[model samples]
Target: MRVEDAPEAWEVVSSTERFKGRVFDVVTDGVRMPGDEVADRDYVRHVGAVAVVALDADDRVLMIRQYRHPVRRLLWELPAGLRDVEGEPLAETAARELAEEAGHRAATWHTLVDLLTSPGMTDERIRVFLARDLTPIPEEENGFVPRHEEIGMPVEWVPLPDAVEHALMGMIHNAPAVAGILAAYAASVEGFTGLRPADAPEA
Candidate 1:
């Protein structure tokens, strides 16, 4: 289906800063009907951001355990975040998020894909990257709030195969993490045509 074909119009109604200091903007959008009638709709405009799947020399994936308030569940997933600030490019954002969320940095960066988290209602896009050539950097050096607020985050290295299995089995609930890990494996394996190494383009 063509996304542009969807009939919608948006106008900025107002914007406000929440208690957490996060800016929340309300948008008035119009939805077209079968008879060319339009119904105004309202939604929010959130700054987009990135996610990174960092791998170490042991072929183990770097992951963090954290709590998600929306689902009311703890999740095991790749390092990710929203643009803590506006006007940040996705590649740099991905690198920064990896360091902040996982307390790690990559010497090399490769963009795997750009994905739409929710295209129907929100303007959120997640650029997923594959990071290797890692060097452990301190969380303080990264200048990020640790993954958890009251408690500390446990960063674990899960073997890639096991991570993939867990993802398929629904144990790893982070969509970006699952997608990133599978894409990374495809790039490394000879038979995975859907993904090619970041250093090389698909044939």
Candidate 2:
């Protein structure tokens, strides 16, 4: 629970409006040292979020291509969202986001793991989930079908082989999405990794 000898060495600095009018705050804290000494430290205080790494019956990973305004780049990542309300449980957020963002429901859903997106100064954690037996129920106000170039958020079925390949090749390069993929792979060893395009024994 503690970090660098100071488990609770953080406090919210200033709350501000996040994207879509969401509110977030910056946290300032200190690192507790030996003999209970404290040194100043600060981080981006975030409520954290949940991300789902879903797989269809065909063993394909569901992904979304998003054009991040901040980074000014298009990224392929697992469906993810911020924790909306105070009493909102992570699973609830995950399920809701999976539908709203990815437009799908999982017949089988399980929490794979939790990842600290940035442990240096921020407590930004993202819960990684493994979702299976998915059914598409597209959400309104999502995808390129809605606003096209204005919002480059679209879902695509990315095969596992290409997923890893592109990742290794620096194609699908989003931190949370990459973490979700690795976590999913660690959870289901019997499920992914083994065959490659070059290993097909010639077409």
Q: C-alpha displacement of 23 in model 1, angstroms?
A: 5.2
TM-scores, one per candidate:
0.76, 0.74
By TM-score, the best candidate is 1
lDDT of 1 by residue, 97-183 (tens): 777777787887777766676666666667778888899896457666543441587789999898889998988978788888888
Alpha carbon lDDT at 114, candidate 1: 65
Q: What is the C-alpha lDDT of each candidate?
A: 0.72, 0.70
lDDT string for model 2 (10-84, tens) is 343334433322444665555566666666655676778888889888778999888887789988888888887
Error of 2 at 92 (Å): 1.7
